[model samples]
Target: MRTHFIAIGGAAMHNLALALHEKGYNVTGSDDAIFEPSKSRLQAKGLLPAEMGWFPEKITKDIDAIILGMHAKADNPELLKAQELGLTIYSYPEFLYEQSKNKTRVVIGGSHGKTTITSMILHVMHYHNVEVDYMVGAQLEGFDTMVRLTEDADFIVLEGDEYLSSPTDRRPKFHLYQPNIALISGIAWDHINVFPTYENYVEQFEIFISKITNGGILVYNENDPEVKRIAETAANPIRKIPYHTPEYSVENGTTLLETPEGPMPIEVFGAHNLNNLAGAKWICQNMGIDEADFYEAIATFKGASKRLEKIAESSKNVAYKDFAHSPSKVAATTKAVKEQYPDRTLIACLELHTYSSLNAEFLRQYEGALDNADVAVVFYSPDAVKIKQLEEVTYEQIAKAFNREDLIIYTNPVEFKDYLFNLKPDSNGMALLLMSSGNYGGLNFDEVKKLV
Candidate 1:
């Protein structure tokens, strides 16, 4: 089949292009610009466009389908051409549903820990040599691509994002997947640009729960009142199973599971991750993985990329870079690190990166998020605010919002890095947790790790 992608240079879109290309489909795509990794990977597969930007001439009746990425605008030229041609258009998630309609879909969805939960399930499946089609948001170890689709696989595991499907398709991406088995790790308000209000944001999950196939199973985090309510009030008559953090203890900064088999050392740490593992376990169990087998496989499942990922560590000091920006995420991550190393003096640094985070009104949501840390800092660029076309956010305003008078804020990445580098060696234990969805103004992680 001939498939063309609009805004295909996106991380997920490029992966989809590559997956289709590998599956022997004729894949073509266009993007105004492409970044590294996606660019290189697409180039390696000879799928990179000879020239950048849209060419409506490329659209023709011969193409079987047009896949749209979220990065493109509603009036994108190629999209206009595809609509004009009356070609069958699919959002990435829509295409995924089309491919897996015959298969048992297992979708993992939530504001936080969905990627980790999905990754955990895949890890167990991979460990047992189970061949299942899968899609995850992060670059996981032992997986070549973020997305995989196959003709013969009877099961497909998907990390179902709550983000919009595409510019033209306003529905949440997860809404497209009518999963036979679904899991929600937790819920926190995000994507303020799309949903706008907290109530509107919550209604998306309600819609997702309702979208489950009849008699489907729902594994949810009972700890999250929102998720609990959704699962309880779900209109669909589905088998509802709730999970919370499993019994686990931290030993020397490593999380050890309290299992019937005895205390099992696990590669991943954090209460939120333990909670994620619990949700993943229920999903895997429903998919036919026994409790013993799941426990064995998860022990070696270190972590998903950028979810409290260890950048550098020593006996005295350690550093972690996490994809945490939301108020809930910030608080959860801060507490997780502090709890893991009770003796360590936690120094939490966050970059106000996303649109919601950079908003003046949204700033107040961060109250008490950094209270777990011994030292707290919030970094945001004036240039970034201008680039995102947001009103100016001041350090004083941020401090007031967070309700921390001692909080240090930075407007420059260099000065921020220098401050981090020049920190006096604390006599007591110390842990540095850097959190953001965006890179701290192109700060080199490797150099920062080395500095740590």
Candidate 2:
């Protein structure tokens, strides 16, 4: 089959293109801007566009399907051309559903922990040599691509994001998957530009629960009241399973799981991860993995990239970067690092990058989010606010919202980096948590290492 992608250089889009290409389908794609990794990987596959930007002439009717990435605007010229010919145009999730219709689909969804849970299941599957097709948001250690679609794989694991599908679709991506089995870890209001209110944001998950196939299975975090409510009231007659945080203990800076088999030492730590671990276990168990096999595989799991990734470390100082801009995520990550190293001083820095986090109203949600850290810093770029076309927010506004008068806030990236570099931490009692969905004003990891 012949397939074309519009705005194909996205993390998910490029992976899907590669997946289709590996399956021997004739694939072509175009994007206005293609960044690193995606550009190089596509070039390596000989699948990179001859030139950047769209060409209306490339949208011929002979192409079997056009998969649209969220990166492309609704008025994109190639999209217009495709529509002119009455060719099928599908949002990323819609296309995924078309490909995996015959497979047993397991979709993991929520405001947080979806990526880690999905990665854990994938890791266990890979360890046990369980063959399945999958798509996860974050890059995993062994996985070559985030997406894998094949004819023979009977199961497909999907990280079901609640973000909008495409400019035209105007629906949450997860709603399109219609999973035979599903999981919603929790919900918190996000994407203030698109979903203006908490009620509006939560309605998407409700819709997701309603779309599950009849008699399908749903494994949820029983500890999360929102998830428990959604699972209980699902319109579909789903077989429900509830999971809580597993019994675990941190001893001498290493976290060990108290399992029925015995205490098993693990590379990954923290309460949020442990909660995700429990959910992953239930999902894996439903997919035919025995408890023994699951426990054996989970011991080696390091975690998904950038959830709480340690980028630089020395005896005196260590620093981590996390994709944690949302209020709940920021709070969870901050608390986790503090718990992991109780003896060390935790210095947590967060960036207000995403639409929701930057909003004036949403800033108040962050009250006490970083209270676990001994010293907390918040960074944001006014240039980024301009780029996202959101209203400008003031330092006073942020301070008032967070209700943290002692908080240090920086609008410039260079000054922020310099301040951190000059600190010259050699106390052996300090750890730094730099959290953001965007680069800290493009402050690279190389500069971060000099802190020690």
lDDT tens string, model 2, 1-452? 99999998999999999999999999999998999899999999988999999999989989999999998998999999999999999999999999999999999999999999999999999999999999999899999999999999999999999988998998889999999989988888888787888888888988988888999988888898887887787767889899999898999788999899789999888899999999999999999999999999999999999988988877656788899888888899999999998888888989898888877778899999988988889999998888878789899988888788789999998988877877655455678898988888888876776674
Q: Can you list the residue pairs that collide in candidate 2? A: none
Please name the candidate that would achieve the greatest lDDT relative to the true structure.
1
- What residue runs in model 2 are displaced by over 4 Å at the alpha carbon? 426-428
Report the CA-based lDDT of candidate 1 relative to the real structure: 0.91
- lDDT comparing candidate 2 with the true structure: 0.90
Those runs of model 1 whose alpha carbons end farther than 4 Å from true positions after fitting are none
lDDT of 1 by residue, 1-452 (tens): 99999988999999999999989999999999999999999999999999999999999999999999988888998889889989999999999999999999999999999989999999999999999999999999999899998898889999999998888788999999999999988888888888899999999999999999999999999999999998898878899999988898888777888889898999888788889988988999998999999999998998999999999987788899999999998999999999888888899999999999998988899999999999999999999899989899987889899998889999998899898888764787679999998888888888866655
Candidate 1: TM-score? 0.98
Clashes of 1: 0
